[model samples]
Target: MVDSIIPKPKRVDGQITGLAGELFVAAELLKRGIQTSITFGNAKAIDLLAYNPDTGRSFTVQVKAIRKKNVFPIAHNKINRAHTYVFVVLNKPGEAVQYFIVPGTTLEEDPDRFTHWFTDPKFPGFNWRVLQDLGHEDAWHVFSEQA
Candidate 1:
């Protein structure tokens, strides 16, 4: 039997998908011995705040999640330079979720990194594969370095 290149995405609400991504990130951080907290709709740009208790450092994170291996929609103007960006691919059932941890400065310094669609000019986004190719998958060390 052959496997599909892109598995069918799980049918889930957008809000739920976003929340799942945030929770998953928080869990991963905690597992790595970092303290994490979810802002839960209070913060406009930040979704998670993580702290390295050992280092006494904290940093903000913004999560963008998609149900499948697709583009993670982002508004160019809303990219916060001080916050880290975690792009998540929530694959089908029984499949492991994938994360691409990228620093916001990367996107801020490079305009070509964003794929701006002519059809939806206002909703420019980053392709999941592109992030993977850039070697950002599971880049958990970013938090350690920042926090």
Candidate 2:
């Protein structure tokens, strides 16, 4: 007999990918002296709740994994109420993955949306042109400090 079965995306693939990404982001936050907590699901409005008790402030972070440059948006509506939103772009050029952080708010306000570069009836598209013009490189930084 010949094997005639095709493989599909396993449920565990998504869970593993999500957890791994969260771990990467959380580890980075820890290195930066930010207190971080992981909320599994069904929370008030955030996924990862990170805080700096010394500063008495907290930020809600939503993580998205991308195999390509334009697979996902920088932010979603869930992060609208967050003190800060981070886009952890994972670029896997080869065996290694590189990360670039973009501010969700900036993407939302990008004027390029008027040009129809990114279009979604339910959610607005980010302005890639504006993001490029601002000289925002790919890395982790405070959302408050940007163009």
Candidate 3:
């Protein structure tokens, strides 16, 4: 038996990428027994709001979803220590998803390293580089505070 390519994408075009990333993260939070609410639309910078009912701990999540494999740039106009960044990388066709939860302070401390402008085969724009070496990968404990 052979495995099939990644599940067919529900929608075509790049318009849905942002929403797809947001929903994907939101779903993961929910699966972890955390309550999540999406704040769609350009009205707010926060994409998802997560909360832990038991600890009364809530978090403002800014999700950055990258469909292609490049250094994705995250806007750093407003950096809030209380906020968390959920970097969702939708690996190429049929691959698993990658999540990097980073605290706002991580970026605020050194804005230049994370945020920058560059051109790739895909497009030319600014994005915050989410490198795994930072040790922030899958840092969900920012909300749970568990070891």
Candidate 4:
């Protein structure tokens, strides 16, 4: 067995995969006539920022991507009301990616009970289950909602 402290190659792929997802999100939003741009190098929690020039609807978008077509984990600290999340699944190479757009508040809310999980730091393994359960699959209206 070889001993080396260098991180595995998969780690680098993950970073590129993440950036690919962010680009895909930006492209989709732009295609839909939403003014969108990626935050260079993701210096902030937001990966993309979008605005509907006509209505001035805007969102601070955080994108999460996974190589497999499954829900991805989001760091608990990154959830916020002024934010929207774009979940992406990188399909086969050169194939179109899949996306699920959801609002941050929905991440925290239990619509039936009026409770939330996003603001709770106690939760370490919080996935996008709540947002998924809300049927945000490709739901783009969350952006226009701010208008």
Candidate 5:
């Protein structure tokens, strides 16, 4: 009989997949004409910083990518300081993905807690409406307008 539950990928593979996915998403954002950069290390919770010359508004995008769509990503801090929180959902083989943009205020009102696997609570349980499915063309249009 086949095993119903699937096994997780090795740690190294997981990291590599995550890195590749993030880069792909970043490129997609840039192609859409949003000035963007990916920051490293843990000093700041935000991952990608995007700016719009037209609106002159800076948006902080925190990227959380999950392998499966049914499973969502979560953040403990609730992005009180960022203008926006972006959850990038990815599928295995690292091709298909979606973006969820949640306003900072929404996260600000939520509670935060610590966990064993991850540090914070309320991070992995994101809502659905916030999600926006994106491809090359759609991503470009939305980000360009947003910027």
Candidate 6:
């Protein structure tokens, strides 16, 4: 029923999906009056940079996105403690996008505690569930606090 409620895209493009997620997060941050910019590149670690002029504060964000509700695969070595993470679910056309805002320190502190690592020798990355169980959906206040 949940799957049915959220439609799936007919085709998936990794590049487009990733860019869309970054844009969506940027838009949300802008809506909250936070100045945001997307750092575009294949090798870039930080996707979005947000600043709050009122507080004179700024922070980096790394975005991970999927077309539907599923585990986000990430390399354990890539987690940066100074960056905040935003896991995005870009469901389908007409469906609302879901965002899970989490601090990178939460993952870097103890990755195994929050992610499921693949046992395969070739593909040794971990899958993160995006703190859904912890109720981090739409946690836009994270930026406010950081500010």
In model 4, the Cα lDDT at residue 71 comes to 44
Q: lDDT values of the candidates?
A: 0.83, 0.55, 0.73, 0.71, 0.56, 0.80
Which runs in model 2 stand beyond 4 Å of their true positions? 1-12, 42-44, 68-70, 73-83, 89-94, 111-117, 122-138, 143-147
Summarize candidate 4's per-residue lDDT along 1-147 as a digit string, tens digits. 356566657544677888888888898899989999888764566788889987777778888888765446554555676688778877888887777786777654533321233334565333444445557778977776644
| Candidate 1, residue 56: how far the Cα is off, in Å | 2.4
User: Tens digit of lDDT per residue, candidate 5, span 1-147?
Assistant: 367878887664655555655676678767766788887664566677887676676777766566666544455444454556555656666466666655655456533321221224543454333344222213333344442
Q: Write the per-residue lDDT of candidate 2 for residues 1-147, one digit (tens) a residue.
A: 247776677554655666677777788788778888887764345557887756666677776554435544533333353345444445464644435455556445653533343455565545433444455444555622323
Q: Which ten residues in a row have the lowest lDDT in candidate 3?
A: 119-128
> Per-residue CA lDDT of candidate 6, range 95-130, in tens?
999898888787777766664563234554444353
lDDT of 1 by residue, 64-101 (tens): 99989988887666677888899899899799999999
Error of 6 at 47 (Å): 1.0
lDDT sort, best first: 1, 6, 3, 4, 5, 2
Number of the top candidate by lDDT? 1
The TM-score leader among the candidates is 1
TM-score of model number 6: 0.81
Native-referenced Cα lDDT, model 1: 0.83
Candidate 5: where is the Cα deviation over 4 Å? 1-18, 75-77, 109-124, 127-147
lDDT tens digits, residue span 1-147, model 3: 248657776665554777888998999899888999999786676889999876788888988787966666544555676788887888787898888887877766775555344322244334324456666667777778631
Summed backbone clashes in each candidate are: 0, 0, 5, 1, 3, 0
Off by over 4 Å in 1: 1-11, 114-120
Model 4 spans > 4 angstroms off: 1-12, 111-133
Q: What is the clash tally of candidate 3?
A: 5
